[model samples]
Target chain A: MENSLITADAVEISEFPHLAQKYSVRGVPKTVINEEYVIEGSGPESMLLSTILEAVEKTGSG
Target chain B: MSFIKDADRPAVKERLRDMRSDVTLSYFTQDVECDFCRETRELLEELSSIEEKIRIEVYDFKTDQEQVRSYRIDKIPATVVSNGGASGIRFYGIPAGYEFSSLLDAILMVSRNESGLSDETRKALQDIKVPVHLQVFTTPT
Candidate 1:
């Protein structure tokens, strides 16, 4: 995803408290897309892709 | 202070051998120190030793203001995996445990300078008009 227009970052919650709070992250392995769609746990790759696409559609960018 | 165990080194080295381009791991740290800064640096150093294409460049977060700004790094234990270009790939903490494998995969991908994405994905990404930030939060577990 890094090569696309999508910029991916692996953020460690323990180091960045502000980001965790901003995203309302209460648990581990949270995937946040554009700070809009929040996937609580690690699921199938298709689920992750759909979640991101869903957010993109809602944001009127897709 | 070996982060990579002896048993894992052979396979890791074997995988790293596929590297075709140079990949520099630009690691940022400060004198005051963050929780895992030292460990992060050590891990990067060990990784660099595994392959000729891999290299580590350490910079202080406070002293190396220019490098920090250049890499757009704002936090400690930050690593920018780049190969002559800004790949927009970042690790904001120590790439340990399962994350270590992710780091290796990132290095390989950046070295190849390919996204390894499907044709559909490439077409889909082409449709994007704005920058999408994807942040994956995870622990070592």
Candidate 2:
């Protein structure tokens, strides 16, 4: 998974714009799964793999 | 304000019936004000009745701090669409207009326990280790 391009759109610039707001975003390309899991940003395949593994373990979601 | 026309209920319910997981929509709002708040509350209530698995819960925004805290809710007419998981995911402001599509997406995701995201989208979200807050803003059309 080469870093997915989930760029902050214009709303990010116009609505709540700030790098301090970066912490709020937590990380780029964050994808929320079932609203139960959230992946921060691009990482090594292992990182993403673990995130999925952990989310499944935690949520028991199909 | 029943934004969803009566004509549209059949399709929405038909689509919703495909869900295979437990789903609940928790609404937080104050009674005294906000025109959109009342509308949202009614819309969700009606939506809930469309199915048995689709449940609804309403709480006072000003009086229910504990409930609000549980969901980390910070806005009126806020909604937490959870798939029987821990709550906190919030849809701030009224989810009307195009944002309702997102609301429907969230409901389907929760109810199906399936997130059919692209591999690339999944890759992008696969390494988050912190609490990420996502706020999407839109105006009712």
Candidate 3:
């Protein structure tokens, strides 16, 4: 939500079973960027930013 | 029954005291068959009571088609935290337990109208030309 180009959704896996299954969220704090890059656990801010950038790159190329 | 404990009201109020602008929590829910919708609405009500700058606008997900489309909400019990503008910060379920703190932080962040990201990170985000959707899944614990 910080950036204008980004939309962030915080989903409680227990409440949204279908989403949990679709995202294959077996752990807490699983972050899926652009439905492409998945961060299994909580990471540093830099790591999340990098993953988002990488997702953007992949989307652009594909 | 109140969703927020009485003992935590003071601390929650203190935390919300940093808000510089009015924040609106646009909550979407329906009348039936949705889990945690009532609880989420009640939670937002209790939260709004703690700070005058915080307000909630409730909408029925089944009937409020225009709002649902405008907000781009795809699910029930969704809360879009914004300061009279698009913030893109949303919670797809009840923001309880540890996630409650995140809701508060989002409110404060939007009220202040600052992302609080590092300069380097902000600079790095400028290169992006496409929309990036981030779905973070977590449990209440």
**Interface RMSD of the candidates, in order:** 2.1, 10.9, 1.2
Ranking by DockQ: 3, 1, 2
lDDT of 2 by residue, A1-62 (tens): 11121111101212233522543554334444434455555556656556555664565433
Model 1 C-alpha lDDT per residue in residues B1-141, reported as the tens digit of each score: 699887888899998877889999999998877899999998998888777788898899999999888767877799988898788888999999778888999999999977787677667676876667779997776
Q: lDDT, candidate 2, residue A47? A: 61
Ranking by lDDT: 3, 1, 2
Q: Candidate 2, residues B1-141: lDDT per residue as tens digits?
A: 467788988887887877887688898878795646787788788788776778889899889989878766655667787766653345655666656666777788767755665676565455544333333333334
**TM-score of the first chain in candidate 1 relative to the native first chain:** 0.84
TM-score-best of 2 and 3: 3
**Residue-wise C-alpha lDDT for candidate 3, range A1-62, written one tens digit per residue:** 45678899999988889999998888888999998799999998899889999999998887
TM-score of chain B of each: 0.92, 0.86, 0.95
Ranking 1 against 2 by lDDT, winner = 1
Give the winner by TM-score: 3
Question: For each candidate, what TM-score against the reference?
Answer: 0.86, 0.65, 0.96
RMSD of 2: 8.9
lDDT of 3 by residue, B1-141 (tens): 998999999999999888999999999998784889999999999998889899999999999999999888999789999987789899999999999999999999999987888888878886688889999997878
lDDT at A3 for candidate 1? Answer: 41
